[model samples]
Target: MPELLYWLDLFGVVVFAFSGALMAGRYQLDPFGVVVLSAVTAIGGGTIRDVILDTQVFWIKNPLYLYVILLTAILTIVLIRCPKRIPKRFLLIADAFGLALFAVLGTQKAMALGAPISVSIVMGTLTGVAGGMIRDVICNVIPLILRQEIYATAAILGGGLYVFFNYLGWSENFSIIFAILGALKLRLAAIYWQVSLPAFQIIEKNDV
Candidate 1:
């Protein structure tokens, strides 16, 4: 189970790093920018979670993560010479996959650290979205988490499902897979339909 999870984590990192590099490409950023963005998008959330938990950052503790991110970013740069031709769907699909995996993986890690269930869920959501948030902010784009979108909602739902499944004595792999699918399906549905949560509004006191 542990070994399986490790592989999944590495794959997730590659997917995420590719997505970030693609975004950098969209902005016509140079090679260094691509690598920097890729690294942050691949490991930012996990780094934040580990720091908050008072643990060594995952990639720092194991250089394998760095190697994968670098390799993925380099490959993206090579293969995507004209990034403008890259379809928007590609990034969205990559993000959905990364979100689902990181959300559940982060929850599991928090649980391993003996965090409370509530905190674990929050951490999971953070792991899924925080990197994207930073990436968007740095690129001068609005972060998806701040939008009235179903993005973080999907992450929360995945984290919640994983916790629930574990509590029911489900096998770890089954629980993780089910939770990832739940989040991925919802995110894809939202993207297909352009679904978003209703935004909150307030009436102006000075208005008629």
Candidate 2:
């Protein structure tokens, strides 16, 4: 289980790093700025999760993750220099994959640490969104979670389903797979169909 989680973490880091690099490219940031953003987008959520959980930060403990982020950043820069620009949709897809993987992984970690289901779900959602939130803030854009689209909503639902499957005596691998797929499907559907939750609005009244 630990080995599987390690690989999944690396995968999530790479994908998230790509998304961050894409944003840096869009803004025409220098190479150092690109790598900095990639590192933040790759590990920001996991760092927060570990801090809140009082666990060792994963990347600090395993410097391999940092190496992976550095390699991913370099690859992204190389891709950026290609004749074709990276598609905007690719960023969304990568973000969705990261969201799904982190959601399940966070929930599983919290559960393993004896947290209750509710707290586990919240941790999962936070793990899924934190990196992207930081990325957007640094990029001076509205965070995707704050957008009308079902971002955190997908993570929440995925986490809930993970707990549900665990309660049903499902295998850990099965539960994780189900949660990731569920979250990814919902996110992709939302993106493809432009589905979004209604925005909050305030009305103004003039008094005589």
Candidate 3:
């Protein structure tokens, strides 16, 4: 079980790392900045999760994950210099996959730590979105979830589904596949239809 989670974590990190590098490249950031954003986007959530869970940082304990993140970032930088334009559409697809992967991994970790379902869901969403949020902040842009776009909500739905299926004694592989598809569908649907959360309304002040 531990080894399974480790592999899932690495896969999620790779997907997010690519997404961050692509975004940084699009913004024309220098190579160093690109690598920085990729690292943050790949590892930020797992760092937070480890801190909150009072465990040794997962990536530090497993250095291969960091190595993979760096390698992918550098590879992405090379792609930026290619003559062909990289499709922005692929970034959304990568983000969806990353979100789904993190959601299930986070939920499983939280459950293993004996957290309740509500807490597990919150952690799962945080794990799914924290990296992207940090990447945007570092890149000096609005967080993706705060935009009029679908992001964190999709992660939450997927994480909830993962926990529900697990409680039903479903196979781990089946649960993961279901959660991943749910997240991808939700995100793609929102992107295609421009669905978003409600914006905050300003309250009028009463004259005394």
lDDT of 2 by residue, 12-98 (tens): 999999999888888888998999999999899989999999999988888998888889989988866976565679888999999
Pick the winner on lDDT between candidates 1 and 2. 1
Report how far residue 120 has shifted in candidate 2, in Å.
Answer: 0.8
The estimated TM-scores of all candidates read 0.94, 0.94, 0.89
Ranking by lDDT: 1, 2, 3
The lDDT of each candidate is 0.90, 0.89, 0.83
lDDT of 3 at 181: 79
* Residue lDDT tens for model 1, 123-157: 99999998888888898888767666579989999
RMSD of 1: 1.8
TM for candidate 1 is 0.94
Q: Where does candidate 2 have its weakest 10-residue lDDT segment? A: 79-88
Off by over 4 Å in 2: 198-200, 204-208
Clashes of 3: 0
> Candidate 1's C-alpha lDDT?
0.90
For model 1, which pairs clash?
A: none
